[model samples]
Target chain A: MKISIKRQYFIEQLNHCLKAISPRTTLPILNGIKIDVSDDQMILTGSDSEISIEITIPAEIDNEEILEIEEPGSVVLTGRFFVDIIKKLSGDFVDLETTENFQTKITAGKSEFNLSGNDSNQYPLLPEVNDADSLVLSSAVLKTIINQTNFAVSLSETRPVLTGVNWNFNKDNISFTATDSHRLALRRLLDKTFNTEISNAIIPGKSLSELSKILTDSDEDVEINLSQNQVLFTYGNMRFISRLLEGNYPDTSRLFPENYETKVSVNNSEFYHAIDRVSLLAREGGNNVIRMTVENNNVELTSNSPEVGTVNEAVNASAIEGEDIKISFNSKYMMEALRAIQDEEVTIEFFGTMRPFTITPSESSEVVQLILPIRTY
Target chain B: MKISIKRQYFIEQLNHCLKAISPRTTLPILNGIKIDVSDDQMILTGSDSEISIEITIPAEIDNEEILEIEEPGSVVLTGRFFVDIIKKLSGDFVDLETTENFQTKITAGKSEFNLSGNDSNQYPLLPEVNDADSLVLSSAVLKTIINQTNFAVSLSETRPVLTGVNWNFNKDNISFTATDSHRLALRRLLDKTFNTEISNAIIPGKSLSELSKILTDSDEDVEINLSQNQVLFTYGNMRFISRLLEGNYPDTSRLFPENYETKVSVNNSEFYHAIDRVSLLAREGGNNVIRMTVENNNVELTSNSPEVGTVNEAVNASAIEGEDIKISFNSKYMMEALRAIQDEEVTIEFFGTMRPFTITPSESSEVVQLILPIRTY
Candidate 1:
């Protein structure tokens, strides 16, 4: 197999695929990137067992010659070293040729590197998904949905299902939910079209992270097809696939409270800063608990560690309703929830001292974050 | 103690002093910064036994108000927490007040933080150095000298002296040398005004690394005073004192030979890239040794792992003389020394197959790097 491609354009696509390749794969060939060249396009594939990314470069882009295929073939090369060499190679065009003995030669300008290649047949094949069960959503919405909820997923392997974010789709809406038992994050987007109704799946948090980076923020829509064991997201010429966790996700809809005795609205930045300062002192303590006292027009946040000292800060609030109450919760969870709010002002609701509370944007009911209160004296 | 200072300016000085403060200190007072407010200036000090830094903020700079001293007093505050709070404070001017009970109030904008302060008498005093044995050099030259030789120091604690760089000053020139015993780097500068003949002293590589970041590449001169146990550098209203490592430094002047059997000249960038590529394969093999063979005008660089096959590439040399020879050395050491040369083209002088060779810029003899050859079959 022999091919010559533009260095810059080829390097860009290789970088995206490299994100899916893991350095600690037990199978030696799984640590490589598989390359397939055909008469019309060139395909690059990188995967670990959990996630796989494949990108194709077409024959023509803006009437420029990108790839010239002398022969159609496939080969797998070391992903880490090959990417470094290509990025640092000083030339406009790079030439790749593979011999029948599985020896590959790479040349650009005056520099040439030869590396041993593995048989492409050794690489795992991607599972096929039916197009009829595909769903369509804008890239911007997809990235936001992942970033907002993925961080709340549990990282421990003991509870494997909790390590993945639960995705549920209806006729025209998509909902994402994640929880570590201590805190929960949920986001919903309406107007997304889905071919199937009321389907639920648990996708690993790690795969969503890699997918978030590859998705563009443009208005272009991305196509997603789901199967019983795998999910595939196709954007332009790139195909991203991930293995789904085999378990039923816990019901998170009941975790958020339906009503609250007290609610307070405050500037998002001011409230975030107040919690940030209190966290410095609480972080030194064992439980990372910070207390909030709400009054008529002022909210006071305080935390103390007997060994270190205490911090007391108060910020003006937009409005306070019902009975004034004091609530204590994890400072880190509140900070993360406040940071995810897109609006300038946020409204926080409290049911009781021990029950889970809810925080949402002032005008939007689309995103809600819940944190279980920590009992403190 | 009572004072009001511009928040940004105070934070900058605090940031500089933070370099000397280590997170974990056996003596509790050493982890705190000493703040002294006098009638004329405000001083901040941070020390960790091996190194100490003191920065003074005068009452006025260019007829501008920088510090307002309301009362004269001194106190020590925890370095780690103080620096963080000052950096995140939201105010243009910060008000600092110390109570009789030793609790200090730091007020900025609408936020207030109260931290417990310690007695200033508990902090260690800075060492004294005589002005009679002082030398002056521009910050740029001092910084350059440190950068070129610091990378060659040994990181192992087995040989304490080898972990520091040796500085030698004679009647007309000053020189710096560092080596981990495998390779050595030496840089010399001729300054006739620096006539004091001082003995060699080894300064810790870690101290020099911190000083390099504080010193700017400007024409401003910094004063260096050498005493029996310590070295002091004063510049821009700041004094930096570092304890010198005690031991006799190894004599490396005898490492370089007066003559050579072969000499070759090559472009700096081109040679660097060739060695970089060859090292990729060599690193996988045990010692990262790359062999070079010179036959008249053609020079070939090769490396073989036996299991991973072999790579041979020819690089163009502008000049080659004497007999044909093949030698092997660690590619990493060769590349580092080549990068330190301050010329477009460098000349390498080889004494024999087992002896160490020297690489120097063709245009000047101010800097030289020597690497010992490895035994390869």
Candidate 2:
């Protein structure tokens, strides 16, 4: 296979594909990026066992010959070093050619790099998915969904199922939920007649994170396809396939308390900053717990470490209802929830001591964050 | 200690002094910052065993009251938590008052932090240095001297002396040299004079690195005092004291080859990038060794990794002198040395196989880098 492409364009696409490449893989060929030159375009694929990413570079772009396909063939080359060499090559265009013995030659200006390549036949083929059942969503909505709920996924390997984001979709809406038991974050988006019914699937949180990163600064619509054990996301000229986690997600609807004796509406920034300051003392405490006491029209966040002393922060807001109750919870969980809240004002609903409370923006009660309070007298 | 100070001013000063506070210090007191309040001003000091930094916030800056002192006393508070709390506090002015029992109160806006403070007597006092043996040099020159030689200092604690930068001062010039045996970097500055005879002192590389970072963005002259076992640096109401490394610095004068059989002059950026590209392949081989073959006016950098293949880069140069030669050296050392060279053109002088080579700016020989060649047939 032989091809010549514009350096900037090739590097940009290579960077996105490189994220899916594994630095270490049990199968040696899995560490390589497979390149195929066809009649009209060239495709680059990089994968680990969990996810695979592929990008296609068209043969001609804007009347310029970006990729000149001399022969129709394929080869798999080292992912990391090949990407680095291409990026550092000081030329406007780069030429890549592979010999019959799987030796790949890369040339740009006065620099030339020859890398040993594996036979393309040895590289595992990505599962083929037919375009039968697919869902389309704008990249912005998809990104927001991931960012709002991805942080709550459990990082523990002991409960592998909880390490993935669970996506549930019905005829009219899509909901994403992730929880580590300590905290649960849920986000839902409305759509016009989603083709699939109430189907639930879990995508590894790490794979979605990489996919979100590669979709940055793009406003195009993304197409998603779910299969028996694999989910495919296609956007622009890139295709991302991730293995689905095979397990049942814990039902979190019953965990969020519906009744609240006290509800406080506070400015998001003000509350976030106050908790941020109080967390300084909370961090010194053995348990990073910060207590929020709502009395009359005032809200106070306090943290105490006997050895280091204590911190008290009072923020004035519009009215507090019911009993003047106090609840202590992890400051980190609250901070993360506040940061993810996009509304100017957030409404926090408290149930009782030692129960999970809900934090949701007043504008829309659809997205909810539940934090389990710690009991302390 | 009771004082009310502008939050921004206090935070800025704390940021400087906080550089010397190491959270990993074994001594508990060393992890705290000592605050001394006087009727006229307030001083903040933080120190680990190796280095100490102190900054003074005057009562008034340009007739505007920045600090209002209610009492004159001293106390020590935990450095890490205090710095973080003050930075995140939401107020323009911060009120700090110490109770008779030594508890400290910090108030800013609606947030208040109460931290147990230690008696100032528990804090170690920095060694006093006289101004009689002091010299003044622009922060720019001092920073340049540190950057040019500090990277060569050995990071391994095995050799106590090689882990520091040796400063040699004469009546009219000062020279700084650092070496880890594998490579040596020497920088000299003229027009800087000392009242006494040549004074030699070795300051820990880590301390110099911290000092250099503080000197960044400052162009004013800094007064430096040399004592028996410590060096005092004073600038803009800030004093930095570093414990000097005690041992004889190796004599690096004879290490540089006086005359060379081969010399090559190339654009610094060109040569650096070529080596950088070749090193990508060389790094995979083992210790990142790249070979340069110089003949006449051209130089080719090549790296071969049997399993990964090879890379060849040709860099343009002005001229080459003497016998044709091929030499191999660690790419990292060459990259660091080239990065420190100030001139656009760099000249490398070589002796023969397995010998050390000197790299210097083509225009000036004051700054030199010597790298030992690696024997690879």
The TM-scores, one per candidate, come to 0.97, 0.97
With a 3 Å backbone cut-off (N, CA, C), the pairs that clash in candidate 1 are: none
Calculate the i-RMS of every candidate, to one decimal place: 2.2, 0.8
lDDT of 1 at B220: 93
DockQ of each: 0.47, 0.87
lDDT (Cα, tens digit) per residue for candidate 2, span B1-377: 78888899888888888899997899999989999987798889999989999998898899999999888999998887888888998778999899976899999989999999999998988888776867888898789889999999999998999999999876677889999999999998777667644379899999999999999656898999988888899988899999999988888888877779899999999888888899999997777899999876678999998899999998887888888899999999999999989789999999997899999999997899999999987
In model 1, which runs have C-alpha deviations exceeding 4 angstroms? B307-309
Q: Which whole-number lDDT from 0 to 100 does residue A90 have in model 1?
A: 68
Which runs of model 2 end up more than 4 angstroms from their true locations? Answer: none
Give the top-scoring candidate (lDDT). Answer: 2
Every candidate's fraction of true contacts kept comes to: 0.18, 0.94
lDDT of 2 at A72: 76
Q: Could you tell me how far off, in angstroms, the CA of residue B200 lies in candidate 1 after the best superposition?
A: 1.9
lDDT per residue for candidate 1 within A61-142, as digits (tens), equals 9899998888788899889878877886767889999986778888876666777888999899987776676678789988
